[model samples]
Target: MIFKAIFSGFGGQGVLMMGTSLAHGAMSNGYHVTFLPSYGAEIRGGTANCTVAIADEEIASPVASEPDYLVVMNAPSLFSFQNKVAAKGVIFLNSSIISERSSRSDVQAYAVPCGDIAQDLGNTRVANIIMMGAFIKKSGIVTPDIYLKSLESIMGGRKKGVAEINRKAFAAGFDYVKD
Candidate 1:
């Protein structure tokens, strides 16, 4: 089965990183993966988005016309993309920044306080990773083990303590999903 997910937030919110890491993790899981990061002129604090697609076969498009999953880290991103989610899709919203909620009944929606969770975890920067965990665990798009490996590789060779916190964020997110 093919899985398509869209992640959106302000530029500095690690949207691109999340998409890339998801793609990498999916690839590690023996799936063909593609990631496309969207751009905005204002950069920091400006809108940003990324599309990640994973499939056992070749992917038709990197941009998701109808995503199986939508992770919205802010209100505007939610407003812009909520309508594009497939009827039976899963939407994971960042409750800390998204004041608006989807009215669609067909899609499975979960608003996780990722930002708040990250804050409690001592670093709000890892909020996107937290949401990624929820996305993976709930959607089953990629295994948490693969996700953690990808995350470690993404962190590069330096930066002590970051990997641990990020791993915790991912674990928290993964564990939060309703089984």
Candidate 2:
């Protein structure tokens, strides 16, 4: 079974990092994965998005015309990609910034206050990581341990305390969605 997901938001929101982390986690879990990123001309404020495909078998393409999961960190991303989600797909929206909900009834939508959670954590930069934690918990595509390990690998070179704060942020997001 192939699972495709699209993560979108403003460039500074770490959209590509979210997709890349998921892809890395999936790959580390012995799944075949692909990561494709797109961005506008502007470096920080422009639109940025990425598609990640994970499967037991090799993937044929990196593109996801109709993704199984859509994660939107901003309002514009929700409007731009909501219709592209396949029927019965899942959508995770950052309700902290986007007040509007998905109009589609066929899909399951989750509202996570990622920005607010990160702000409460004293680092708004980890908003993407918070969203990622929620997505992983809900989707069960990859274990949180593996995802954190992948995240640590990706951010290992960063300054001290970054990983700890990200872990806390992930835990908060994961806890926000009850099973």
Candidate 3:
């Protein structure tokens, strides 16, 4: 199967990290994948986004002109990428930081309180991880177990307890939608 997704948010929100994790997971599953990242100059609060394409066969391109899925971490992201999604595509919004709603009816939209969930998990930085959890749960591009393993692998040689909190954040996001 071919799955094209776009993750967008402000800088320092881990938008690129989430896309990279998905790309890594797809690679681990023996799928061909491509990731393209775009961002502004600022380290934080500037626009940042990434496009990831995963498929069973050779990928023709890395640009996601019309992605099958959209992960919006803020209202601006939702507004910017809402019209770019293909019909019947899925959109995941971080409702905790964004109070607005999408105007599209042709696509499936899920509002996830990623920021609040991360705060509840004791670290607001993992809000993107929470979003990743929700994305994995909703998109099914990769299994949650595999994604978590990928996350741990990426965090290799990091500070102690980072994996535990990230795991909990991922689980929180995963269970948030599952329940």
Candidate 4:
């Protein structure tokens, strides 16, 4: 199976991290993966995005012209990437921050309140992880257990207590989608 996904948001919103985490998870599970990140000049609030390709076979390229899945954390990202989603694709949006809806009817939409969910979990920075959880649940790209372990491995020595906080954030997102 092959899956192409794009995660887009502001610079500080962990958009790249989300894609990186997915790539790591896919790689750990014996999938071929590629991660490519793009960002604007400003560090915190400027546009940032990444494309990740996961497949059982070799990846031909890192660029994703039309992705099967999209995780957009803001209205701008939705506007920018919505049209590029493949037919029958799935789009997950941070509805708490973005009031706009997708115009395409062919793609499935999951309007999870990622920002609010992260805030409720006492950390707004983890909104991306919340989205990640929802994506994991809906798409079945990677199992939660595998993703959690990959997350922990990726967070090694990043900061104190960050792994646990992110773990809780991911669980919150996963539960939100299941319900």
Candidate 5:
């Protein structure tokens, strides 16, 4: 099985980190994965995005012109990448800051209030993690336990309380989406 995903948002929204985490989780799950990150000139507010490809076998390339999944953390990201999603693909959007919905009808779109959820969790920086939780739940690319373990491993050596808040944020997002 093969899965390709694109994560996009403003530079400071942790878009690349989200893709990196997903790639790491998939790799730990024994999948061949590739992560490609891109950003505008400005670091903080400029546009940022990444593509992650996961498969059971070797992947030929990292670029995804049309991905099976797309996660947009902002309205501009939605507008920028919505058309690039493959038909019947899945889209996870941040509804807290994005007022509009995807115009495409060929794909499934999920509205997640990542910003509001993160704010409620007392850490706006974890908005990406919140989105990642929801995406992992819906996609089922990797088990939650495996994903969390990979996340903890990647985030090791951070300040205290970081893992706890991230766990809460991930759970909040995972619970937000229904089966």
Candidate 6:
């Protein structure tokens, strides 16, 4: 199966991080993976998006004009790429920023307040991991453990006390669906 996903939001929202972690997880699973990131000149305060595709066979294009899954972290992220999803695709929104709900009827949309969830867990910055946890369960691209490993690699050891909080945040988000 070819799985294409897009992560979009303001730069600090960790959209690109989600794509990178997902790509690494898929690569660890021995699947062909491609990660493409798009950013504007404004950077951190500007728009950013990344496309991650995992396939059993050699992947085709890295550009995902129509993605199977979308992880949006902000209102602009939703408005910018909501129409880019495929007919049967799913859009996962960070409900903390988007409350009105998407009106697209052709695709399945889910609103997860990952930022709020992370804050409730005592770390507002681990929102990305929270979103990833929810995404893995919803998309089935990789297990939460693999995703956590990928996240560990991405966070590395230099980013202060991030890894532990991120792990906790991911666990919280993962458990949210079950509880």
lDDT of 6: 0.85
Worst 10 residues of 2 by lDDT: 38-47
For all candidates in order, the CA lDDT equals 0.88, 0.94, 0.90, 0.91, 0.93, 0.85
Residue-by-residue lDDT tens digits, candidate 5, 1-179 = 78999999988899898998899999999999999988446656778999999999999999998899999998999999999999999999999999999999999999999999999988899999999899999999999999988889999899869888988999999999999
Scanning candidate 4 in windows of ten residues, the lowest lDDT window is: 38-47
Name model 4 segments beyond 4 Å from true: 39-44
Q: Which RMSD values do the candidates have, in order?
A: 1.2, 1.1, 1.4, 1.4, 1.1, 1.7
TM-scores for all predictions: 0.95, 0.97, 0.95, 0.95, 0.97, 0.93
Q: Judged by lDDT against the true structure, how good is candidate 1?
A: 0.88
Return the candidate ranking by lDDT, descending. 2, 5, 4, 3, 1, 6
Q: Give the lDDT of residue 69 in candidate 6.
A: 96
Tell me the tens digit of each residue's lDDT in model 6 across 131-156. 88878888888888888888788778
Off by over 4 Å in 6: 159-161
Residue 131 lDDT in candidate 6:
84
lDDT of 4: 0.91
Q: State the lDDT of candidate 1 residue by residue for 1-179, as single tens digits.
A: 88888988888888889899989988888999999988546656788999999999999888899999998888999999999999999889999877778988999999999989999999989998999889888877777888889889878885879889988999888877778
For residue 135, model 1's alpha carbon misses the true position, in angstroms, by: 0.9
Regions of candidate 3 where Cα sits further than 4 Å from its true position: 39-44
Of the pair 3 and 4, which is ahead by lDDT? 4
RMSD of 3: 1.4
Query: Relative to the unseen true structure, what is the C-alpha lDDT of residue 57 in candidate 1, on a scale of 0 to 100?
Result: 98
Q: Which 10 successive residues of model 5 have the least lDDT summed?
A: 38-47
